[model samples]
Target: MTTATRTLQLKAAPLIVEAEKEKKPVKVRITAYTGGIMTVPGWGPVIIDLQGLDLPQRVTLLLDHEGRTEATIGWGIPKTDGKTLVIDGTVTEATDAGKLVIALLKDDVPLQASVGVETNQYRPLKPGDTITVNGQTITVESDTFLIEGGILREVSVVPLGADKQTMVTLAAGVRNMTHQPAPPENSSPGETIEAKYILDLLSVCGDDMSTFRQAIENRLPLETAKALAETRRRPVIPPVLNAEVKDTPASILAAAALKLLGKESLAEKELGAETLSAAASYKPRTALDLCGMACQMSLGYAPRGTNEIIRAAFSTTDLPVALGVAANKIALDAYQQAPATWKSFARIVSAKDFKEHTGIRLTGDFKLEELAAHGEIRHANVGEETITYKVTTYAKMLMLDRQHIINDDIAILDQIPTIFGRAAARKVADLVYTVLLSNPGGFFSAAHSNLITGAESGLSVASLAEAIAALRKQTDADGLPLDLVPRVLLVPPELEATARQVLNSVELYRSGGDQLPAGNPFAGLNIALEVEPRLSNTYFPGNSTAAWYLLCGPADGSFLVAFLNGQQGPTIEPVDPGADKLGTGWRCYIDIGAAAADWRCAVKASGA
Candidate 1:
């Protein structure tokens, strides 16, 4: 018996099963153990000796290394075949788990095979050592080892296997049936093929277990499953047709945009090519043009001029939603395109509500301890701290009146929102920088052990070294070294050239007394330099172009910018302008808040 476990990858052939036969147990043959260099968790890399391979006559097959009886779905007989170990097994279709395995196999779902072996004879090999085994030369890189013998204790079917080369080959399903049934009809061939395709897609995107199970139970349509899978892969807020837009007018506008963007294929597929073709006939030029189109669709007649179109659009119930959709698209594009440097180094989270949210900062997990024979196991304590912040709304309104529509001043709808969108992005940047520049209660001072000042602290190789050292010296709540690495260098526009020189230059020479050339330590460090003009803007308090910061990546949890409901960007919605106001007004706002979460992940160099 062996104590050490090694995972090996092996190649497998596709599962082949006939549809005409009665359902029975699935026969499987797999290359259990492929002799080669494998990296074992906790033990590093090791090579199992095939000639010294030890195993029982049969071993139970489990699921993902679970030791319970319910996990044991089958058993296999193992035998040595050259450098590999092969296993022939039958997975019974009696149990639910067993039935699932068979069904997945029949649907062409790929399941990897892993074996849990215990190594009894093994020894660590020295670095740079070379040995010949299984007709291949192996070199020791780190903590490499050689296992002389091991027992193939158990086999398991897993979602992901350490070995990529090994695979479970399912045998052609032919059962010893007692009786034969009448042949099935082929009347529903189309539906059968569609169902099969959908099932295959479901298996491929089976990572979302709940969605996968739901799709399987309901036997969802191919398009619906595809949409769900695609949405699961990468979630994005579309420019239109999102949750906010539900009315017919908004849908029409969304469809029109989709048609204009040449993404008509999906729309055409879902809503006939004829419908899209008709929409293509009427191309809306301006806000007034869209209003006129909406009026015609809802009122059965197009308004005469821009004023009438705007009035008609404003009068309709769902017409504003359509106008809002177009405005939102413009604003969203601009907001995304605008620069927001804080995103580079600050963690952004979604706040569930406006109430004060408590964020738990777990310094680190408890270390694993050894247990003595019959000794009581003690629980280790974890280090944690709480930080609280709440999201608040910030907004302003832009009016789309009759004047702009009559004059056809497109900037009122286009460039105005574009400017506001960029401003919304800038607003977030301002809030994040304010936390540092304000330096409330000396947050970045010597007391915090993060601030470096004086003329010598200016942006340079030497100064950056000091800042990097400060950040790396940060410790967790447990008083252990965090070993935080600085990933971004934040500077004002005035120090952009200096920051680039320190980061990009291959070598440097010290000024004054020492003129000796030295290799730039910051070069090739992959530290990004982000220059924010607002940091030195006179409009802000404590404005200093000389101030620069070295910050860890966002994952380090140094600083945080939270959004209400995880909406990172601004939200634009249509607002009633009242009687005095002629046209529709749009309110652009963002629900967000920023605060210092962890002081250890950033070091400020006051370049005064």
Candidate 2:
């Protein structure tokens, strides 16, 4: 602890503090405690015992712990002149020299800890290497890791730059990546709904400077950021309910419902099938246009007429995310959030719970029956050894399905023929149930997200990881993920030799002048990552499967909701009670994908 000092050139009250290390960093004020002395014993390496020291010859005051001259004031002032003057000082410098070490403080009881250096001293000789450590926690990016005596868990590593690495991991409640989930035997998907309410007005919520100030601060709540907004008539803009001009997820989802009813498409075509920037959530396509394709390819379920389910699109909100009308108007355009462009569309089907939408939603821990569902782990190495499947890495795996949709009928799926059979289906369902419900070793809970498991369709850890890595950044390293944003991140598999160039060079953010300037309004580009692991559960780090999204729009921009799917990976089994098969496949693409959407998009194309 260090304090600034002022050259006492006043001829009034005497300022004194007891000579002690604890009484450091004092403020020189001639207030009520003018003649009072503050004493502190010692701090860090320094100890003070104010014994004999020079003092002013006039009626000066004294302050010392051990009577040694810790500091002096009023050296040559006239005797007792009751005058008041304010003295301040210049700022101080920063250095590691005065820094205090931090640690995981234990609440139960304090432990006997010495310098950690001596404990790890017995390691293979190396200089500057972390020789020894105990009870240590480190955060790199969006992941948190703990080390005890030198072991890592909950945190993994991946290469980023040639010389550096990106500390990435999945968030909670996401059984697999691609942000999809399945429904179970009884329940069904909610009806294709419309935004019964629209957020079109703006009003002042309140004027609490503290709360308002907190909101306007960087990366805080947009509605209440008082300082961030113009301090004119009102500092705060109410949400859709009040003056909230931004679009709400609920409202957008509702708009998609209307599209199913034979109205004009929510997403109007700028050119054609390309998802338009003016679309809701910044997606290029509508849910209805894509859900049918997803059902046909992934679950083998054809929509009777129009499948009614909650349509969703996932993307990132870069600054000025074409709030169509707002972007049209240069002034408001600045407020539009430009979401990353990898928007995937899908519909959550509630009616097809038992048939096309079939998945096991494991509500509890892994039980014996769950294991039996898998039959034998390869050579029946179950309890004896760890029969680890893709346990959730979010590691990008190359996609065999070309058009950005999961397909079970891919040629690569046929190779692992074992992974596409009946027992495997049960295992897959159980895994989906577990993936939907379990965390492997994370804080996500499937129940919190209301996941629906099903038969006709499912997600492969490989695909999910690839998509996740491509879209998000592990910004927060805290265990609870407070600062975590539902951005995207992805990686390609080692085998994607053909597509590696495009996946790496174009999809990734590079310095081709596409590099975003520091503090760009929109979140930087995050999409179509390099594929790596081939399964969803096995690839995402910490087996994290949870994500989040915040949908925003300009005052004038509006959107229609639609459904789409990015996965239809090969089938492992079918357990559809509604269908004649033992288990149905996942349909509706990923109506129930990750707990959080993690992306945004403007509605792209729409049709009646």
Candidate 3:
């Protein structure tokens, strides 16, 4: 390759190096060795050689490989120099007269500078050509050019060096550059250097090979590790069956399985097998026999049979007992929490479990005897009267599909108990309200002589007081005063406001503008005012919205609401597998009823 050289002469002016505190440029000649690969600091590999020859040893070398020009510095390298050069200039005029008029920047302040141009062929300077002076580069920033006074070019220029200074400022504004040690040549990206070093150190410190082998062997497979963890988490339970038997019933097997599955009490091996056998087949297999056969088959100890398969098919899948218990709990909780609207007013009596409840109310009193003057005494005939109430069971069944159990969708199943419970409570309230409104016992009829009729008269103080007096005047079969006191005034929603007014007012107002001085004789009466929504609209033919009642105290038992003794609320029962038509369902039921016990305890006023 042929090598060429060109010399570029810079202005022989004082070049002050601010970083080195030097005042003047140094004279030096640099001889470049060409046509060879050389590595530059900022520029990558290039086909150029730089060799020989400079002046002061302190001067730094800078090369513009593309321009093929070497600029020598007297104090420091341009790359390393901390001082920045800013060229802000405008070329006002350029001429063939070898002079140019321009505006230049000194210390960031704009000033005028005259630059001389040397050309042999009288080449005129233009507005847009880039130029450098004293190592400061500038760009023609504006298109405006003016020629005056022998000047050929006039333009605005911005210093390019300012761009470099800006770049440095931006880089400094970002995160600090920290020098990180180079990674090992053979190591992967994620490999820990400290760990490798520690291992090496350990190997050098100890010569025990057995420990190293043990450490390697200690690493377990993922599956093995998981299995070990699972084993540790499982609770240990003692075996319920000590010896294996040849013929085990399906129920016994189920019970044993349940015990193993963490439900010991509900296992009920004997009872469960017997119930299932009685329901499923005439010759039923015992739970123990079926389960034992299954176990044996798993161990190759016995052959599989149709009966075993059937038993497995009916298996609870470890959820029956748990679900049953949970359902019972949910039902009981829902029952207790359900709103007791009418039940709150009626008297509740418990009935024997699975049996009818009887509420007895005595209507007649003992006969009073009169004294006799003769030797013989006179005796009055005694009479006994009784009213009986009985409650019957109301049942509902909910079915679960096989898919639900298989998918473990038990949350929906939990709602069954609560739904059943709330339904039972609502039934009880409806029954009580129905009884009161229907007055089936003639409690509100004229036969009972408690119904007061007058269409023109609405609920007024006089009318209510009359009703109360009539109730108090009621007598038993012995012709004695019932001694009854009105405890509550039951009214329809339409009459609730009128009832409160009549009971709460401190003074009574007459239709003729007359007022009673005893400021509301009903004040401090403490009589409970009850508004029954069911009574607002007509339920039965005579059930009137304008009707109201004066009832005896709750302790007097004018009305009786009865429930099964032990089964007061609601009960949830898991259906036996064989007997279950749907195969997956439970029964929820309640035994409750309500009736009017004694007509003497209350009186009704049919409001007009």
Candidate 4:
């Protein structure tokens, strides 16, 4: 006769159980392999047995959901006399036969699961053994187990969280329920998050959320926000509490709350409104335009009528920096407009390209000698000399009243920079001119360089001709004739008429001569007469009203004027606003030095 098959249905309850509360059971479908375990949601697993039911019968089993238990099966029908068969146990110790000595606890009695040599392949277990049976955790507390015929006997068992002592002992190996919870959605693992990313997240909450989110997000510190909010006159309603509000994005919630309290956004407010408008309207053209755009953006913010605020915002712009730029432009214009007076007669050299200082070497002149036929040539050592000069910086400061900036009169503000620039130009011209005229010894004193022989009589055709002859006859350090020709006749304003008459005349008259038939010795001379006021200025030491110079070509290096290479003219810069007494004044300066490098290139005559 064929035995009919039976169906055994299995189900698991939630791991946490309250006897009085009802919970829906999770159905467990058994597959062909009964060894596979099934788990309950928010719970552990359960093992089922489907082979024991009688044919055409339905059986339901209720399993312990929260307490400790071992894997087992009942050998008889429900509610009938039957023996319970235990299959799992806690390992107590290893036996000499290489088996795990196990014990089962049932009604406080001991049963053993050791099979001696037959269980030799099983790993030897130690006291405090941990093992899982049908999702229930079990621990072995003793090394000894009462065993009968290789079966598991009584063993001590404890629930995982039944007591504080058990939790403390198991916490090292497992994550205890008291450990910190996992990160929430939209949260990261770092201590801080990017502001932009936070802003983006707030945007996702909704446009209206901006008011609330901006309150907290715009504030630097929570205390500051609180203080600002406390000062507001109007009472703000606290946000409504609900599921959606509770779940609102963190950034949006923060900003919205701040908006409600009427706390200003520091970042937005600090950037002035004018700057923001400028930035929005600005279109970048060159690389400089890009810089301009950045300046506008940096200064852009809420509008405040205070001059300090407006100036502070503008301080971040290129305008203040442009002050120095304007100064430089002014200096350049001044240098370009340099008078056609002294510079035309003096050699000008740039000093800026020099790293620390510049030097002018005056080499001794070389002399030519007739060479002997096939004989060794004699070498003459003309020692070299050097004159070193360094650049000096000059500066001036100007101030603008705080009230002027407040008025926002750009026209008034503009004039100061231009004035500063023009001032720098004037300073440069004055410096170069002073250096050229201040030293009379470079021209009139023979002891200076032998460029002058002795004090000549008053300015006249004969006196001028004598001075030119002296310059032509002068020799260099090598005792060779310099072949110098006087090109410019430098004089004071008092002698202009005499210089013009002497140079323009076609003939000369001698007061003591009886009769002389000859052409004018001063005629057809291409000498440019330059009248400089500083020549007779009493400020310059040793300058005489009648002192005059017959100067050679500038290329001849009779006098040298050096300027810092790229900075051939004065430069303008803003005084450090913090250090300046004049809050709005800028400084203009020039770096320059001048000296007569070689006096032999000109002849000086102390006129009577």
Error of 1 at 10 (Å): 64
lDDT of 1 by residue, 2-106 (tens): 233333332433333333236467788766656666643323355777776556546778765544455667877777755776778778766666777778877
lDDT of 3 at 101: 11
- Candidate that beats the other on TM-score, 1 or 2, i.e. the better one: 1
Those runs of model 1 whose alpha carbons end farther than 4 Å from true positions after fitting are 1-241, 244-247, 254-278, 285-288, 303-309, 375-377, 510-517
Candidate 3 stretches with Cα past 4 Å from truth are: 1-318, 350-380, 402-409, 506-513, 537-542, 577-583
Question: How many residue pairs clash in all the candidates, one count each?
Answer: 9, 146, 23, 29
TM-score of each: 0.55, 0.14, 0.44, 0.46
Q: Tens digits of per-residue lDDT for model 2 on 563-605?
A: 1232222211111122121111211111112221111211100
TM-score of predicted structure 3:
0.44
lDDT of 3 by residue, 430-505 (tens): 7877887787757776776687888734788888888878888888877788788888888888998999899988
Clash pairs, candidate 1, are 2-118, 2-119, 9-163, 9-166, 10-165, 10-166, 10-167, 11-165, 11-166
User: Native-vs-model 1 lDDT?
Assistant: 0.65
Say which prediction, candidate 1 or candidate 4, comes out ahead on lDDT.
Answer: 1
Cα lDDT over the full model 4 = 0.40
Ranking according to TM-score, highest score first:
1, 4, 3, 2
